[model samples]
Target chain A: MSAPRPVYDPSWDRANPNEVRRSIRERGYTGYTAGLAPGFVQANICILPKDWAEDFLLFCQRNPKPCPLLTRSDVGDPSLPALSDNIDIRTDVPRYQIFRNGEFTEEVTDIRSHWRDDLVTFAFGCSFSFEEALQDDGIPLRFLANNNVAGVYVSTMPTEAAGPFEAPLIVTMRSFTPQNAIRAIQITSRFPNVHGAPVHIGDPAQIGVDLAKRYQNVGDPTVGEGEIPVFWACGLTPQFAVMKAKPPFCITHAPSSMLVTDLRNSSLAVM
Target chain B: MSAPRPVYDPSWDRANPNEVRRSIRERGYTGYTAGLAPGFVQANICILPKDWAEDFLLFCQRNPKPCPLLTRSDVGDPSLPALSDNIDIRTDVPRYQIFRNGEFTEEVTDIRSHWRDDLVTFAFGCSFSFEEALQDDGIPLRFLANNNVAGVYVSTMPTEAAGPFEAPLIVTMRSFTPQNAIRAIQITSRFPNVHGAPVHIGDPAQIGVDLAKRYQNVGDPTVGEGEIPVFWACGLTPQFAVMKAKPPFCITHAPSSMLVTDLRNSSLAVM
Candidate 1:
C-alpha cells in the first residue's frame, strides 16, 4: 500500500559511500543515513526551481555559518559530479520532503517522479563532519551517547536577508563540561565549512534562548548542572528561511536523510 | 640608600629583546617588564642549588601546563645561551626575589651577589606569549585594557608530586564575552609552549576557587556579568611548589619583572 517504509540494513553502517548510495538506489535501503559511511561527508539537501536559486545562493554566501555551500548541481541536472561520480540526485538520497508553496506536502523515498527540468539542487555542509572530528579528538558528546539529538532553538539573532529569504537565526545547542567545551571549540574551529566554532556559550538567555523552550522539541532539551550550553548556527536556518519565502515548489532531504559524498571529513578541515 | 627604583623608558616598548636586556644589565631599567619588547618571550626565572634542581625538573615535567620549562642553564653558568646569546641570569631579569629557608627574605635588582657555583637557573614559559596571540587575533582582554592583571586562584586540584615539590594548582582567570571567550580558546591552543589551552571554564567553585578570595590579592578579582571566566594553569604554581619544598636558598624573577629573551612569541605557536 505505502511503498513499504524504507528498511535499514545494519551492514550499511560499515559500507563505503558508493556502496551505501547503491543500496539506497537499487536495494531500497531508503532510511535515515546517520552513522553510515563513517568517514565521508553527508550534506543537507535543498532543491528549488531555477528562478528562486539565485537568492538562495546569496543567502548561503551571506550566512555561511548556517549554510556553508558544499556544492550545487547545474540547473536541470540530477547528478552532482563534484560530490560523487555516478551520483543521481533524484534517487541517491534516502528520503525526500516535498513542498508546494513552502508547505511540506508529502514525503517520498525517491524524487524521480517529481523531478523537473527547471530545478536546481543545493548541497550544504552539515555539522556531522565536525561532530565526528570532536569525537575523534576524545571529547565525549552526551547527546550521541544518550541516543538523542542536540537541542534546537530559535535565537533572537536575525540572519542577513537575501531577497525573499529571511528568518531568525536557528541554533543547535549542546552541553559540555567546561574543559571539554573548550576542547570542542578548538577542534571545531579547525573545520570551518561544517559550522565551525560555537556562536555562543554560557548563559542562553544572553542569546534569548530559554533552555526549556526548544524549537519543535527536536532534541534532548536539558542542560544539566555544571555543564555549559554551547550554541552553533544550524543548517535548519535555511529551511526556516525557505519556509518563510514560500517558493512555489521545493524539495529537501528528510531530517537525518543526507546526501552522502566521497569527500572525507578531514578534507574539509582548513588546518 | 637602596638602589634607585628602576624608571620606565617609554621608548623601550619598541626596543629589541637584547637591547631591553642591556638596559636591565647596564642602564638600570630594573622595573616590571610588562609591555616591554612586545613581540619577544618574557620568562619566569628560578635559580636553585643543584641538589634541589633535579626534583624541581621532575615537578615541571609532571606539571607542564603550569611550569612549561623553556630552558635550563648549566650549573655555575651565569649565561642562558639558548634564551639569548648575551643573557646573564644574574642581571638580565628586571628584579629578583630571594627566598631563604622557605620565606621571602628580600628583593634585589641584580642577583650576582647571590650567585653560587652550585646554583642552577631554570627559565619557564609565561602567559604573556599567549596573551599576545589572543590580542593579535583581535580578542579584547578586559584586564589588560584596565591595566590590571588576570585574577589568580589556588584550586583544589593538586600537582603531581615530585619528592617535596607539591602544591595546589594555581590558575590565572580571565573573563570575556562568550564569543570572544571561544575565540580566545582557539587562539591560545596554538601555543602549547606557553600555558596552552584552558584548564577550566564556567563555575569557579567546582575547582575550589572563590573568585572573591584571590591568592595574595594579586589581580582584579571581578568576573563581570555577561562574561565567562576562563582559567589557565599558571607559572606561579612552581613558585608555590618551591615555597612548600622550602629549598635552603632560592632565587626567582620578581612578579611581572621577567627575564626578556630573544625568542619571538610567534616561534611558540605549534600551528
Candidate 2:
C-alpha cells in the first residue's frame, strides 16, 4: 500500500501503447514499459536474421515452457500484422538490446536505423500476463511489492534442444502461503502462452538452485514462513540459448522493457 | 506397483453406477467401491433423523469445502432419484457404520433393520471424483498407487457453524513432485464439489499438523523425496462434527466404502 501507485488512463490517453510508442518514437519518453498498457499483453521481443530464424523457431517449439512464442513475423517484415495492426517491430518497443555474434553490444531506444531486410521478429509471451493475473486474484507476489524483479535462478533441468540452442532452464521464483500458492498455480496454469503453471515448487535444491545464495548474476529469492517457492520458466531462457547459438545478428527487448501488444491479457488463456 | 489393485472392470463392464450398485446389492460384489464406478461420481452417505436433517443441511451449506452436498433424499426414501433411479439407501453401500448417540456401535452389511420413517439421507461429493480427474490428467497420487486411503489429518482450520455441527477441518494429504502437484491443483480446481483444488500445500506444520507425527487416529503419510504435500478438505469433517455433537442416531459408509452414483465426475465440474 505504500508503493507508488501506477498511473492509469481510462481513455486512449498517455498510458496507451500507441501513445506511449509515439512518445518513445519522438524521444519524449524512454523508460521501462512495466506498468504501461496494464491490461494488454506485453511481449519479449527477439529479432533474428532469416537464416537463424528457423533454428530459433525450432528451439522455441522444443522448449515451449521457457520460450512461449506468441507470433512470428515473415522474413524482412518490420510490421507484425498478427500481433497488432500498427506494430512496427523497429520502433514499438520502449528500448531494444542489440547483439552481434552472440555478444551483448549496446542498448538503443529505437532500432529503425539498424533495421534490415531478412530480419524475423518474434514476440514471446512474458510473465507480466500471469503476474497481473496473480495480483488480480489477490495473491501477493513479493518482488512486485518490493518493486524489483521476481527472483531469477538457473535450474539443472535442461531445456529441450534444437541444434546448438540448449541450456539449463532459467526460472523466476516467488514464495507464497500454501493456499495462495495453490491459487497461483491454478491462475497461471490457465495462461500457458505466458509460461503457464510452474516448472517446480518447494525445495530449490531439487531443481539445482542454491537457495542460500542465488546465481548472483540474476535474481535471488527470499522464502518466507508458511510459504513455498514456486518457479516458472523465465523469458531469459531464450536469451541464454540465443547467446549460445550466436546467430551473426540478433535483437531483443532491453531488460524489463517489452513490446506492448493489442491483445488483452485474458485473450491468452487456453481455457 | 506392488500394491493390491482395487477391483475394476477394465472394459467398462462397471460403467454405470446402477449396474455397479445392482452388483453390490445382489451380493455379486462386496469389495470397496474405490474403482467400481470409474467415471461416475461416488458420494459419502450421512443418514439422520428428520429432526436432525435441517441442521445438518445448514451445516453442509455453511461448510461446503468439507461437505459439498451433491443431493438429499426425501424423508425415509430408499431411492435418491437424482443420483440413481434404483439406489437403495439401506443396501447400496458395501458396508455401513451405525452410530447411536455419536458412539461407535456396530458395523452392518445393510441398515434395513435400523431404517426409520423419520430418517433422511444426505449425499455429499467424495474426493474420488477429483482424484480420478487428477489421474486422468496424468497426475499420480502416490497414496492411491500404494493401495491406501489418503493421509487424513485434522486441520486447525474451523468450519462455519450451523447448530451443533462445529468442528476442526479434516483434510486428506497427497504428496506430489513439485511439478505434478501444480498440475493437480489445476485439474481439481475445476470441480468445486469434490473439495475443490486443495485446502493447503507445502509445509504441513503451517496447518497445525506436526510433520513428524501421524494424526491422532489416522494412517501414516508416505511423503517421498522432492515431493510437496497437498491437503484437501476431507468428507470426514462432517463425521467428526456429528461425533462431537452426539446426535441421537447416525449412519455413514464404512471408511473407504462409498455410495456409487449415476453422475459422472466430469458433470460436476463448474467450468
Predicted candidate 1 versus true structure: per-residue lDDT over A125-234, tens digit per residue = 89999999988988877888886789999999888999999988899998888888998898889888989999999999999999899998888777777888899999
The ten-residue window of minimal lDDT in model 1 chain A covers A1-10
**Per-residue accuracy of model 1 over B1-271 as CA lDDT, tens digit each:** 1334456567554468888888888888877788778899999999999999999999999999999999998999998988888999998887888999889999988988888999999999999999999888888777888878899999997789999999999999999889888988888898888999999988999899999999989887777889989999999999999998999999998888899999999999998
Give me the displacement of residue A125 in model 2, in angstroms: 0.8
| Model 1 residue pairs with clashes | none
lDDT of 2 at A203: 86
Q: Provide the DockQ value for model 1.
A: 0.84
- Best-fitting candidate, measured by TM-score? 1
Error of 2 at B250 (Å): 1.1
The digit string of per-residue lDDT tens for model 2 on A1-271 reads: 1222334434346557677666556643556788887888999999998888898899999899999999999999888876788888888777788889999888887898899998999899999999999999888877786777788888999998887688889998988988888888888989999999999888888999886656545554788866788899999899999998888899998777788888889999987
Going through the candidates in order, their DockQ values are 0.84, 0.78
B1-271 per-residue lDDT for model 2 (tens digits)? 1222356545345767877787777744556787775899989999999998999999999999899999999998878988877889898887889888999898887889999999999999988899888888888777676677788888898899889889899988888888888888888899899899899988788889765565555654878887888899999899989989889999998876789988989999988
* True contacts recovered per prediction: 0.86, 0.89
Candidate 2 TM-score, true structure as reference: 0.92
